[model samples]
Target: MSARRPIPGLGAAPSTDLPVLLPFDRGKGRTPDIYLATRWLASLPPWTPLLILAVMLAWPLVAHAQGRYAYSDAFDALFRWMPFLVFEGFFFNILISFLAMAIGTVAGAALGLAQISLNPMLRRAAWFITQLFRNSPWLVLLFIVLLAFPFEIVIGGVIIPIPDWMKAVFGLSLPIMANISEVVRGAVQSVPTAQWEASESLAFTRRQTMWQIILPQCFKRMIPPWMNWYAILTMATPLCSLLGVEELITLSRQAMEGEDNHPELLVPFFGFALVIFFMYCYPIARATIWLERKYSVKL
Candidate 1:
């Protein structure tokens, strides 16, 4: 213990007599630390977020089921009406999505082609229309169509009533149409100039060239984005519930309210609705990815 520890350019070595403590271990019957658990979770794969969300959602549901709300009569009622709900709202969602896709594709393709028309007037007109719809908020467009369109058409004393749900379909289709138009325009432009020259060399007129040569090639490019748009459109169809369309969410609400309007039933009813939407949308998303990979042009 004498004062003889001074060194010229080196520090004193750490004392070997002191005990060293390793990082905290969750063994020896000790409780696990929250920080370590969180760190481990954070180190998981990218898909863990979705898995965590599923777990978070399911945990409460499991707890509620095992706890005071164990009877789950609301779920029984929901199950009882499952077929009806599926046939009504779920069916309508699919129907509305397809209808919008069909109309939007046709109208959007027309607008896209027109945007690149030889005539300046047609090009300007198409641009104006596309910009109008594309810039407008979807909900605003839906309301406009819902309110502006006549409830019924009177022609020669024959009345043809337009259902509110049909109006919703029209509203949803507007945005889809504008988007698909852009997809068409971009896909068409993505084609190589050499293809255009080859078509011209084959005596193909501009219209003939677009339809016969360029468009066929554009289809491959268009499909992946089209499926993507379809998925989006399907998700957006829930907005129709606001318009009294009795779509999935609307019907779910009705079911929940009809079951004595119990607070305990809220999670289960909505969870079922979430499952329904997930089942429908998940496949489209997977298919979109697959198609994009499959149909992607080599060029």
Candidate 2:
């Protein structure tokens, strides 16, 4: 075998697979000055991207300080409280997202199926719901849920209070449900008409065919778009902060305004929040791409 050649920025290229995030042809006969940084960035290991981002952000501050103050009281305060607050806040963010996704998935699937119903009234009703939620501003939904929803339910003399967190989840889920309804409808309709006829010839009733023959196939087609929507919905979870939900962004602000927190630490604190979201959502995006490639429909 011939000796292996190395790629610039990246080490020797593997025979089996391309380097993560880097094109195989990245460094072939490249000019020295131009695109140098782009090649280097592409070649970097996954974790290093955030570190590089932090350094670039701090470059302005470092130049402004001119080495006079290597650090600040704000940064110190942020570090002191971050461990306790950031994780707690992030936990609630994830919790709210999980709850909203569960609710949206069930409701959206039903609405999607309803849109294709034989009954004209049901189809029209589903369409109306999808359009109403899809067009309404999420902030307006949040406010409506907050103000209009009853605070408690009384059943047979016992009163159960509705938590603000659940309200937030319902608010966020409204748009997600609408979008997911569209996803389901598109996926179901994408199946060949031949499949429906085949099922009918085999004595499959419409409902039976839908559940047994149609929805099963729709799963693979729906997954990629479903994951994509999940990512979008997760990113939108921060909007819960507007309703006093105490999620990541809300806690970040609280940390910034705390008596011990330094105003100067604002950048680092906000930067940390940004990184947290990136870390959470990046894997989801990657998985979505992988699933799309794996389960892509031939048609």
Candidate 3:
């Protein structure tokens, strides 16, 4: 062969004996920047929530010292209403979260499986539904459900009243269902094509292969995201207060009103809500991180 010329500015050609590396090859074995940031966040001290609670608790006292309000008054009011807030208000919020999560998980899993159906029409329909709700704002979905659904259902001359809280649960479940569907689709698709081919070689039908082999693999992978969504749904439960659901935020506002709507009580009352929610969600977040690490697939 004739002598090969080097490309301009490159000076010399690389040796054929050396292995060629593609641009993406440089990224191999390196953790993603997003993963590092997530790790850093997960490493936060367990006492961080306690520190936040302390700060909130001390806020009323600071305001009192500044001559803005009475510390004892706010403390006494908060203490007196603690049982109501926790038992009735906060518990109601937890109940709504549980209901919404359960409904969402079941519906989302079905929708997700449908998205992977062999039938083109079923898959397309599932895709359309997933994208529609997944892209819709949660608050807007809540409002739509609130308006579109009737207050009661008449079943064979029986009037079954649908409570606002029930409506809130249904509304919240819609977007959650959409998201979990995507999670399921992604987890199922993540399985190696070899496994599917191996099942096919064994004369297994697609349904049998999926249910017996693929779905079982996806369960562990789906858990962390499922928990993360639960935390998100729990936080979003407060949005139902706008729809007149008697959840935590609604009851907190009612408690503040009962306490003469004092400006001083604002920090103490709302602060307690903040602290309790953090306490509930923080452990869940920690557990999700642990599970994610444990279940991460090694390439």
Candidate 4:
């Protein structure tokens, strides 16, 4: 067979064998893939909270039937201390989450940007730091932070006592920072490489391209994961109780002890903690899913 030649002033016939690209096959899709656990949480039924509440209510009755204590007594005690648990203990947990998230987000954003820096040393260092804390157990990080930090600092004839809760905040922030760094780096990289090429053609510097072009596009993509992490961080605040940070779980323990260490109080106090945490985090979970769907890249 003879080879065919191109026509003058005309391109060769367009190829008809182009590959089909399905949405799922695309690098970017309308529905981003979230963690399986997070997807499961977001898929929980609306009755979940009601069912938990019902179980909590029935717990007292079950305790009473077993002759552990009076049913009304446990309920009454839970109600009596509900304000303390919610206002003080749970609120403290929220404070820690907020502080940790703020600190982590700032540091993580910097680290994430550094991970993509042109400087090889800076990129490797950022990656090392991110992976180190990201893989470490949260409780171990908490303990390490607690032990490594001093209880107080003295400077110029002044003593500033560092509270355990502050240490907890710092501890909790380390892992969050690592995770957020990954989130940021992933979001930035997810942007089409064409953006970088386009920016380069426009005479934009790396810093200008990142700040003005890349990051703005990434902000929305980063938000859902950021909020997801915040919800996870809030739930993790209970771990601070082990460090004597006086969060919801710790105060629940104290409340039980104050109630004469009654075995029956266990169900009411701890059950309420479970319910409250669910109520708080479920909304966040739902919001995360919604935002993920909303901001997902449509390719």
Q: Each candidate's TM vs. the true structure?
A: 0.77, 0.78, 0.85, 0.86
lDDT of each: 0.79, 0.79, 0.86, 0.89
Candidate 3 structure quality by residue, lDDT tens digits, 262-296: 88778778888888887787677678778888888
Query: Clashing residue pairs, candidate 2?
Result: none
Q: Output the number of the TM-score-best candidate.
A: 4
Which candidate wins on lDDT? 4
What's model 2's overall lDDT? 0.79
How well is each residue in 186-241 modelled by candidate 1, as lDDT tens digits?
89999998999998998999989999999998888888778777877887899999
- Candidate 2 regions off by >4 Å? 1-70, 297-299
Number of the candidate with higher lDDT, 2 or 4:
4
Q: Tens digit of lDDT per residue, candidate 2, span 1-299?
A: 25776765577544555656645675886634322322333344568547845774675566565333334655666678788666799888889889898999899999999999999999999999998997899889988998888889899999999988889999999988997898899889988899999999999999999999999988888987787778777788889899998888888888877734544556777777777777777677667766776777375
Q: Over 4 Å off in model 3, which ranges?
A: 1-44, 60-69
Better of 1 and 4 by TM-score: 4
Model 3 clashing residue pairs (backbone): none
RMSD of 2: 12.6
TM-score, model 4 to reference: 0.86
- Which residue pairs in candidate 1 have backbone atoms (N, alpha carbon, C) closer than 3 angstroms, thus clashing? none
